[model samples]
Target: MKGTNYPNRWLIALAGIVMQICLGTVYGWSVFTKPLMAAHNWSNSEVTLTFTIAIGCLAISSAAGGYILDTKGARIVATIGGILFGLGTLITGYGDQIGSLTVIYIGYGLVCGLGLGFGYITPIATLVKWFPDKRGLITGLAVMGFGLGSLMLTMLSPGMIASMGTAMTFYIFGGIFLVAVTGAAQLMVEPPVDYVPAGWMSPIGKKSSDGMTLGQAVGSKYFYLLWTMLFLNITAGIALISQASPMAQELMPSTMSVGEKAMQAGVILGLFAIVNGLGRLLWASVSDKIGRRTVFIILFSTQAVAFYFLAGTKDMMMFTIICSYIYACYGGGFSTMPAYAADIFGTKYVGRIYGWMLTAWGAAGIMGPMLFSRIRQASGNYSEALIITAVGLAIALVLPLLAVPSKAKSKDAKVA
Candidate 1:
């Protein structure tokens, strides 16, 4: 592995960032919740269910995308992802035009979710191969686009909706995503098969090599432990995310008009996005220095404290600040987990292995909010949900301790 072309490979990262920015619009779903509720008379639970479905589909599709990425390569998988995502968005617009909840579920929840899964996997695994020397930092840089993507759309979507109405907003965004994602996909090709950095060494250890296929990886005890830990962390993080806009409004000090509340909540969402992006970069870079496992332990411990007190936050600004911390830890998981997976399983089949691991995220998306939604509905407060999430995070802290080292043979026995 020599003669690495530094300039061109960075272009792949640029394309990845562009692609992720488009796919990240889903994080802005909270902005649309009230509009859907007013339009269709749907309950909060029904509306939030779409988020659950979307992530679940994303998890499933990502698994398939990983397999395709490993076997078929990144370009085709990304292209297909773009097409599916754009089409799903377009059809979601159709659902909005007709004011049909079921249609929204199918188009936005299931279809577009599939696109996110495939689109997400491409850059992550590709960059791990391209930038083996900077796994944590490069992965962080590539995914920071995903975190800020929510901010971009949060700022943009409100204006689009006001000018064009909710239905047309989807149409325009769909067109943009189609063009942007396809263009990015063209640049997502794999690097030279035997490439390595100009001045670098294997990170985990001198003898560490890329390990096991998906089958073998699943068989390892570390897999289940890591998966459970990931699941708990994401569940707590996503609870706030799925409910952010409304929660922000509720936490405000005094009674206000709907417009004012919406405006302030939007600002909070923007803050979350900014912090989320920064967390990806900041924490991932930290992982490179202190190591991935250590970073996760830190992530779990910090979030556990935040979640416990979040239930008691009364001031709007303080609420945003605390939730931002939780969101940052959430973003850290996205950045840290890939690097960690590569370290453990070898980068040989990291796309697939990490995709499987993301099942925890998907599961959390589906079930994590149940407690919050139910608790909020019954008690008219998020305190119980916060306490429960905190407890979950504390439990997750133990998983890292139980992660016993296990190895499987790779084709080259080289850890990526």
Candidate 2:
């Protein structure tokens, strides 16, 4: 936004993804569940709480970071986020050595969660500012690193845990997180206030492009509906994600050895992460062409059916496809919502506004894993849990119709 020393906006996006890759490691929590339990003798539910707490903290911290991003800019916020995340991981490793869940909770959940929140918001609104003509695609690229981060970790983490044990594994990764995030933070910057692409033209009557403050967005009925839609989408996906390794191993034929079963489950889980990243790119790109609302309808509707079929499938091939579909759609929500908001509310204030919207992800993080764990404990299987999610998705299919806003229908529809 200043002298033309470094005016390449795409470079800023690349930097954003580098930091996001480090932050996205949260989704790989399942990879740590067994190791944490075995190392510490914690119950399944107890180990699960770390993820829940982290996501809850992520949601709350992200909301605050968005405000800070709007006020202070991305570099300082992201640098601080890096410090906390790396420190949290280092502390979590120490917590493991001492067998202290409280320490792990404070470090990994509270401190790392803050890092995730701030880091998550750091790049989004900045990218939207730099690439107004490519909002969906740009945000998708910036966030896709997050999904890839999970995929990469899911593949490598088990080996790290097995070879180094959990404590040293945390120490090594913590150091990496610190270096990667802090260095990448240097590359992030807001565009000049009057910045626009060389030949980009604002779409005629693009309602969301009109500037609206946080107060204006919060007062609208559609905001609540959008929140509910995000909640339902995440709950269905994370329910399966929370217990995917265990559930997949169970669904594998009993003839396989325990090691074989675990390996196979890891492969499937890895694929879910891969497609999760790809889906963000693919679906968001499609939204640019077809409109966000229609693409979301297809995403939610397809996943609803996928969840139902997931309950009935015994074959690994079918299960893999269905779960990947669910994961892809689940990921689609993250990329779509930010662009959708900028489309309706204007890009100028979307950084903080989108941050406020992520609370649904926080709420769903708590709901999804707990729902999956509780239902499995009660029923001794994931079938009932799958059916419940299927039902939730079926209901979610109708919510998006109410969520989309047309500029011509009512100006300032929310305030009205």
Candidate 3:
């Protein structure tokens, strides 16, 4: 029998990227930190908490959203997520206008965050089924859009806030997200069951272990191992992101004006976002050839060295390069892990499986930034925190080494 021909998987991928770019707005939250602090007279940790809440919410909601994506469908979940995100943004603007931090937290952190989680999982879960032939490459591309989303924000936000103030910017962003994310979501369609690309065999055929349900995956050691590995990587990267602006300013000469410091920091943040997006594409694509385990091992090992260097470096060029590398590795973890989970657990229920796995992201999201900021606040410098981070990463290097798929039928069993 002839295989069923879908219109083009690339179209699905394109729509996924569009939705992700809007969802990626979460990564750009740092750009608002200083402005919000200045405008609202909030403390560093207080301002940072907004981003943390959003991330934590994103993780929690994604886990729930994944189950929905698996059972209900991607389009409805994505649409609702997009609407919540947009509404959240608009509400945050109102909160700012009212001088109410609580409202800001609800709008930007809780509501928008839930939107991010749902919007995030839909594409990744849907696209992997559509492109089993290029799991690593396609996932990389989708998340690469998410990484780049920050770049657009970094470039536009400075000017927007300067001209219209933070409140108006939030309102504008809310409108854009509502239209963009929801519209892109409308284009998403699940592939037919048992769909396979022409002339390419499903990786399931080349494996001894089949897909595991959410409960079965949770019951295994591999789930926690992978979860821990992702948590450590995300924590390290997110710590830097939570304070990328102030951290950069601290390293600059004292003679620089606050505006100058912010401008320079903005440049660094933009660079961080750019390399972050590209890294997802590069590292995940490489994983396809060299293997995900090797890529992760390389990421953990090298990033440990990078964090160590980042601790004591005062030279701007070296500092920026180190930050870029770390951000790239952080982005790589996001792009690679979905495919990694799919490979091990099987894609049959990846939406639900990977969504639960992202709870690590939620936990790390709260832990990473809060830990980094509180440490910096108390110690008056990020050096000690950076050093501590380096040690944590060095320890996590052993996880990927020990990570292996459970329930293999043979000792030599491997994922294709």
Q: Count the backbone clashes (under 3 Å) in each candidate.
A: 5, 4, 0
1 or 2, which is superior by lDDT?
1
User: What's each prediction's TM-score?
Assistant: 0.94, 0.94, 0.96
Q: Rate the local accuracy (lDDT) of all candidates.
A: 0.83, 0.82, 0.87
lDDT of 2 by residue, 51-111 (tens): 8888889899889999998899988889988999999999999999999999999988899
lDDT by residue for model 1 over 378-414, one digit each (tens)? 9988888888888777777777666536342222122
Residue 157's C-alpha lDDT in candidate 3? 85
Model 1 gets an lDDT of 0.83
Q: Candidate 2: lDDT over CA atoms? A: 0.82
Candidate 1: which pairs clash? 209-414, 209-415, 210-414, 210-415, 347-416
How do these models rank on lDDT, best leading? 3, 1, 2
Best by lDDT: 3
Residue pairs that clash (backbone atoms under 3 angstroms), model 2: 1-192, 208-343, 208-344, 208-345
Candidate 3 per-residue C-alpha lDDT over 96-145 given as tens digits, one digit per residue, 9 for 90 to 100: 89989999999999999999999999999989888777888999999999
TM-score winner between candidates 1 and 3: 3
| Number of the top-ranking candidate, with TM-score as the measure | 3
Q: How many clashes show up in model 2?
A: 4
Minimum summed lDDT over a 10-residue window in model 2 is located at 407-416
